[model samples]
Target chain A: MAFRTDHHLTGSVNIVTALPAEARPLVGHFELRSSRTDPFSVYTNGDSSVRLIVSGVGKSAAGRAVKHLAGLFDSTGSNAWLNVGIAGHESLPLGTMVAAHKISDEKTGRSWFPPMVLDFPCETATLLTVEEETDDYPDNALVEMEAVGFYATASDFSTHELIHCLKVVSDNRREKKLDGKSVSELITAQLAAVESVVQSILQLSAELGKRRVVPRQLKDFLEQWKFTVTQSHQLEKLLRRWEVIFPKADPFEAASPESRNGRDVVQLLSRQLAEASVEAEQL
Target chain B: MIEAIYIEEAVRQHRRTAEILTRFPKARLIPCERYGEVFNPRSQDFKIQKRRPALILAEKFDNFVLPTPDGFGIGGTENYYFSHMLNCLYDCRYCFLQGMFRSAHYLLFVNYESFMDAIDSTLDKSTTDKTVTFFSGYDCDSLALETVTGFAEAFLPFFRERPRALHELRTKSVNIQALLKTEPLDNCVTAFSFTPAEISEKVEHGVPPVKRRIEAMKQLAERGWPLGLRLDPLIYHGRFESNYRRLVNDLFAAVPAEAFHSVSLGAMRFPKAMFDPMVKLYPDELLLAGPLHPSNGMVTYRREVEEEMTQFCRSLLGDYLPAEKFFHCAPWS
Candidate 1:
């Protein structure tokens, strides 16, 4: 599918969960409503910027759901992807929250480290993704079924800094299994922490979005002149430079009546900027 | 402060790694087979990682020492640079490290003996009888993390044994407690880099103020340690001359020229590859928005501006120091 050109979904969040019980707390906490339910269940809030998808159980399912959600929006925008679910640990008490610093695939033995760039709300631990649901948790690590798939797929759509996984300890050595009700209760118990994580990631995504915002005048210039694919890129770069060099001034003031095309405009701005001197106050 | 520490499996049992780990007992420890697994990835953002960079302990397999780029020496016939660490603690906007590496996590090689062995071998194979200057802080600041790395403590004694070999520790840090406690060595020169106060306050984030660094230099000079001045990457502004003159006068007032070993000046320049990423990172940065253009695969100011800045600083510096102590560094030349 073709991506959306309008940046209405910038600084959005896409969440993936392997079970409906794990996703119920997040959907309700974020006030998300059902948006799609044919192939997979998806929920989104009012503006459709915050989304949650239930991927039913297993690695392949979670990977497919992430790919599907990513295809529904403009992937080029600064969006965050998070995998929130329950995992089994050896010694941690039930309802304890943790973020994954290292995720390893038990089948392939390949590992990925998610760079933590923010002051995370919860503690961090190594997470091992296994093929089957087992009570065998590795020493000092959490064992789950879908984090490796969720992370490995989401990385292709966003930067590692914006991709993360937060897990709640639902099963441990003392209690090796839990029902759907218990899983939902465990996720609901930590709803405030999950909300804080979402707020932090959203703030970071917004900061990144601000850095990549295009100059407002570019749209007007593009509508006025016809530019080829390569010339459009050149025009955008020149416009950005003009904005930096002459922030308070307008590029239209420098364009002469003799200018005929986008190339002429690009040359005019380049010449003017080259002649300009950088002042101390500008910094 | 470091929030996490990534330990390479090969160096998990290294003595230096154990010593460093004891310093940050509260940091989360994560183990990996190689440091490259965490450092060399493509999707990581340097700006965000710089906010809270982790510490990676790994072993260097090879390339412990390499020759410095041409025109990068002070007075030695043979100049070599070695990096015991990969990145700096401070986030200077003009730093090449921002463009060279995709990740900002500090990768420190724990195998100090291998570096000593390699330096010893390089000294044995030296073809010239003239002195060989070994430079630290090319890739990382030599003294910024002294308390945590103990880099100066470990390597100073080795250089002391070889009197003919000269060592230069380049830094912008005021962390001179280690240097103050240890006995002074004639072969070691503690070099400090500086810019004008106006520019330093804007671009050099997390760096110690200019006055504090000068105070550190005064303390070192009083203890009989030779010092070097690096007034490099000269930034241009409307009041460039007046600001630089004030800086030079302030520096001379603190430390006399008799304690100086050498001084060098360089203009602001970067390879096109590096400059492109920096501009992308900070598109609105006034320094990058200046009158810079591509010349011979490098981005630098116009020829007249570069020459004018260089000549003005050179003439101003010549009034205090001798001609032999001045060196002009033009890496792209």
Candidate 2:
């Protein structure tokens, strides 16, 4: 498959789990890296792009995976981030596929999840990202490591195109055991549905890619700050905010500078404006 | 910084409406007998109102400062939270905003002065020696909307007047330009909510990256604003120790432990009722993947798992700060 900046890869259907043994067969050939710096391979579906990165388990590793995957896509292009993997379930039956509606960190109670992974046709609920594997989840039903980091880091790089976190229930509190080989069998059984889910995600990304607009609110702030378009992109590129929304606007266009205008307007309104005014005269 | 004006209509006949308006004088008042009429309900999704989210363009507010959630402070008792606006621009899958509001439209209370006046009263009521903490970035990110509202710059002087009152501006936003332009305040703590790099990429929707957030933290710390690290909603994953350790290493590497005012950590837990609706929304997320057992009616990871992670994290934090400074939400001894 050819790589097109405008073409978006959906349904990366990332398997972010410790149950790599479960995901190995269902997924195409896999790659591993010590960290994001290692070169990675991407699967192309002719029209879209897909990269099955084994982001080592945990919020930080997941966050790094998100950052690295986001880096693979042109900042200004359309990209969707996913954390496809297996998880533990409490209420539902074994082998139930759960979508993490929300991803909360057990360590920092701060939430970095999207609203429920809204699946109208099926049941969806919040997925708590725990740092440990245990039956003690207070409110969340499914458990995984990388979802929050993926959402947090990727959302920074892209705009709204990220999607997909299909988690097959591997362990139940009732059972209190994990059989890696058995879990792999369950995922393999659902391979076709997983493929379909991945396809739908890519299709959605392609649709979202066309005519992406940087919110006027963000644009206005960039302008007021006197950030030249290139300068804005430079800051955004470093910030990675421009990664998903870039490669579209001329990077030198007026929107970037205009965004800083909002900041400038506030500066002028504050008494702090006086300091800047004096500084301006010195310049 | 917003050039806001407030308009009063017959709706002022309603006390809440009238009270909301008295607060924002600078806001351009656009009077319509009805705000956008699209707020009715749809059968499929209960979260979105048929009407757009209600927008209250007010002239002022009764108070700009509000008390923080109970059991929220890491080490302090005098806690407070305030919002210059309501609603976030980015739509994440797990946001409580979906469950909390009938509408999605943002409500920007344009009144800056009334809120300031309330702050004065609150400050007067509290003893000067005890730190009266005012928290911003609750209903909205403190700095995310600052470009439009300039709330932080507006209240900086107010908090400055009462140095005894500590101001904490918490946010997941990277809008540090506002914080950068001004001199750092000893009384103010600029706190950023960060997840590991990987979790942020997949789930945070539209927040800034972890590195950029660290950069912003570095910038603020360099400027002398007391920095705070919020390792919130610590998502679990395999090889989790190494992942979080890197996050800690990355953060400390960027900013020194001495520069931090404090670091707070907690796990994913929500009120019982909020769970079902949130679940209905995002059925595909892995963060939701696990055996969900409840404790004391609030939903969260099972007790043993929660305690283990909390203990693990507390020790990790001890590597940087004294054990006395670290705070946990569960309150278990």
Candidate 3:
């Protein structure tokens, strides 16, 4: 699928929640509009940079929702994925916001540790995704469902650094269950923390987009000559070299009317750049 | 400062781990079964993680001290290298660590005693007449994290007792307070690596400036510590001759040539496996884009360019130091 030109999809954020109550705070804050409700409830902002999907309440449902959301957009690894929902801990108080440093699947015995490269403004805890709900909680960990599925599926599309899970403590030993209104209120109270984490991820994603940008002249070169897949790759590298070695000079000045195809252009550029005297930029 | 620290389950209660944890009280502590579980996974972006890398404390099981490549030494018949850490704190665009490791987190083996024991066994097996040199800072900077690791404070005294064994602490960091406080040992050489000031400022991120490093070296020389100069990986540029000449003059002017234990020169080269990833990490880096070609499974400057750059620097260095003090490192095989 191709991204809509009207939307800025690069450096975007895709949020997945297991319940509408869990996703309502984010959807309201980001000013998202309900785009569809067929397979799953989906909402998106006007620019489509911020998207949310509410999967109904199981691990398999969360996994399918993540896959469905990813299939709708052309995410270029620069977009961030966040799985935000409520979890249960043994002794922690309600409304305590915690980010997951480690995620484990109780049934599959699979685990993933998200690299904490950002200085998040929340406590960190281990998250255990169980197959069935239970009152028993692991020591020094938060218990929940859908995190394993959300994390495992999202990782196939993005790097581990850009994928994260944030959980708000809704139920504990003191409080076994919370009503839908209570769940929505708990998430609403910690909206600032959610915003902070999403902003940091967006900053990182934007920085990555800058690094992956191709030279502007590459498009013109492709239009001027016929290049096979292999030759196109070579042409891009050569153009980047030219841009670095001679920032102010035009690269086409080195090409001749005799050049008929991308192969000839690649060879000519390579030969010219090879003989050029390069200088390291002074600080 | 470290923001998070990943501790291996094996070393969670170790004395060194506890001490390191106390230094960073605010850091988030994450526990794992093995350092490899957090450090060796695929799909971890080196550049992104490098912005704020965590520290992984683990216990290394074996192979603490191993033989250096055939020509990677300075005047020692038997040369071996050991690393207490796996990655450097600085982010030089040309560093091979970015390509060699999947993750950018600093993996420091907390078991220093095990490394010392391995070195001692290697020394005992060596012939008494020949010097057994132990090279540090191959995989990471020896002194960059000295304040946190206490690596120099713990290992200096051990090397002081062995007169037949030599230790080379190679680094580009000016974190030499640990060395300054202790009495200078004759068997230990604190070597400093450098490129020209212009090239260093552009590529070597977070490294101390050239002037500050020279001042630190002068202080070490005054304290009677044997010093070494590493002009290795000579970056090729249009002003190579003038830049290198000025750098050599600045060093000799600050510290006397007699204080230098050795001087070495090597051309910039990387294995194809490493070069490809580094380019992918920093596509706009000028150093990687300049006049480099693949030959014999390694990426390096043309033979003539490498020889000319090395020969010019060697000739300039000869004016200040004798030929016996010079060592030229060949490209890695």
- Quick one: best DockQ, which candidate? 1
All candidates: DockQ: 0.64, 0.01, 0.55
Q: Where is model 1 more than 4 Å wrong at Cα?
A: A1-10, A225-231, B330-333
The number of clashing residue pairs in model 1 is 0
The runs of at least 3 residues in candidate 3 whose Cα sits more than 4 Å from the true structure, single-residue gaps closed, are A1-10, A108-110, A258-260, A280-283, B127-129, B330-333
Which runs in model 2 stand beyond 4 Å of their true positions?
A1-283, B1-56, B59-65, B328-333
Task: Residues B1-333, candidate 1: write the lDDT tens digits.
Answer: 998999999999999999999999999999999999899977777888899999999999899999988877878888888999999999998898888888899999999899999889989999977788899998899999998899999998899899878999999998988888989989899999998988899889999999999999999999989998988778888789998999999999999888899898888899988887777778788788767766799988888988899899988889899989986443554
Task: Write model 3 residue lDDT over B222-272, tens digit each, in one string.
Answer: 999999899977888889899998998999899988889998988889998
Candidate numbers, best lDDT first, in rank order: 3, 1, 2
* Model 2 residue B177 CA deviation in Å: 1.2
Candidate closest to the true structure, highest TM-score: 1
Docking class of 2: incorrect
What lDDT, from 0 to 1, does candidate 3 have? Answer: 0.87
At residue B269, candidate 2 shows an lDDT of 69
iRMS per model in Å: 1.6, 21.6, 2.0
Instruction: Let me know the DockQ for model 3.
Output: 0.55
- Candidate 2, residue B225: the lDDT equals 85
Ten residues in a row with the worst lDDT in model 2 chain B? B35-44
